[model samples]
Target: MARNPARRAALVDAAIEVLAHEGARGLTFRAVDAQAAVPAGTASNYFADRDDLLNQAGRHIHVRLAPEESALAELMDAPRSRELVYRLMRDLVARMLGDRAGYLALLELRLEATRRPALRAALTRTLRENLKRNVDFHREAGLPDDGDTVLRLYFSITGLLVEYLTAPGVLDEHELDDLVGILVDSALGIGPHHR
Candidate 1:
């Protein structure tokens, strides 16, 4: 373990890029070092092993993908309504799409977690905590929907992101906004009878 925080962060970020493009099997100390443009042994100094690198990469991707504080504050300041929820969901999609590499790295971490118990536990904890935070935020902000709606939106958005990222042509880009609107409406139970 190296004591240099900046270098360690750099290595982990590089590891994320490697994982995103090369998959778990292609992630190695040398590969990370090359990705980071550092000396050949630099990554090994920062991480104990491949598992350590993998875990750190997973954490880093979440940090990268988290919404900006300013954006969250702006959202909270707005009137809480179904329209707000729709805007939030649209922003979520834009944010995820903006950082395709980070989301792809997260997807890769998910696949690698299936084979590594430690990684699986770590990733599960991280994701659950994130989900809890989002649910809490939605409730605290006096949003129109409950936590269940938030959870459903989370799943729907995740599936949409996966399909859009991994199989780009499968989803029509022009209809994405409409699709997100439908997901929000369905989750909030806003039908012809209800607002």
Candidate 2:
């Protein structure tokens, strides 16, 4: 409930770090304050409750991890194809892997949501908004925009990302590409074989 933007942002970022390293059970206002190297009660000052901090962490994580504008513009400028989809997936996976702790915290948030109706509803809304944004981006990039296709692609990529992030050797790039290529080809009906 504090109005200090810089301090609030730092607390939220620290919440992400605490969530990432400590999981939901370990996430606390005190932990966040400690992570941010601020005085005790700093997070409590800014957040209404644990749920508020968790929600803010989710938003911060998404912002921090979202694709760069330049990369997206490059994709938008390129020809849309299974190859492009594959590349996009690869980049997504790479980013997830690069921020393993953050993604893990997100996964924890998801699990925690399942046990709390309010959190579940909030997470669902946030996820749906993100999905809509992805679909819109796909449309703008001249990629597949069909709802079913986009939905399936979204889940598939998320699952694959989870697997890759949790267990590194589960699939090599060649294998991941092959899987993504199949999904992309199936979704958009693009690629050499589809042609």
Candidate 3:
């Protein structure tokens, strides 16, 4: 039977809450059902198994990063795309560090999905789409359009975030901005011997 989307959404929401609050180790259908104020069987009706529930939750969180249409428009019109980009990434790093334990749980889910063939493929596809969107945003912001270049910068930033978050007091916003500023300068045709 086709499930009720509204109710399913509610369950997914509850699942995210549970995943955030309890970690993947604590997530269970009964807890989700209880969180959603539904019968255990009700959750089963929507998600037949644990992996199904997790995949849905992962997709829900993953979509939050999508850049498309109006999302791209917002990026295009922002004042000082470089600053805006740096701020956004900085804020995410701050949050990731702030709730290191909980966010680490979510990160574990992503890592676990890496070893699961089907989920890994799906994750790779989603990440590729997002990477393309991010590269396009960089081009629109007058940055270099080379995918490999943009991806390298992206990984560098993410790596810095992870390093700082894990090591504590090892990374700061000033350093992050400095690095991004260098990239922006290169991308914006501001360099010695500019043509």
TM-score of each: 0.95, 0.86, 0.67
User: Per-residue CA lDDT of candidate 2, range 130-167, in tens?
Assistant: 99998887776776556576777888888877787778
- Candidate closer to the true structure by lDDT (higher is better), 1 or 2: 1
Clashes of each: 0, 0, 0
Which predicted model would earn the best TM-score?
1
By TM-score: ranked, best first? 1, 2, 3
What digit string (tens of lDDT, one per residue) describes model 3 on residues 10-112? Answer: 8887787787677777778898999899876778788878888877876766543333467456645667554565554555455555555444445656776
Per-residue lDDT tens digits of candidate 1, residues 79-162? 889989988999999999998889999999999999999999999999999999989888988898754988889999999899
> Which stretches of candidate 1 lie above 4 Å from their native place?
192-195
Candidate 3 regions with alpha-carbon error over 4 angstroms: 66-75, 78-106, 145-147, 164-195
Q: Residue 34 CA error for candidate 1 (Å)?
A: 0.8
Better of 2 and 3 by TM-score: 2
In model 2, state the lDDT of residue 48.
93
Whose lDDT is higher: candidate 1's or candidate 3's? 1
Better of 2 and 3 by lDDT: 2
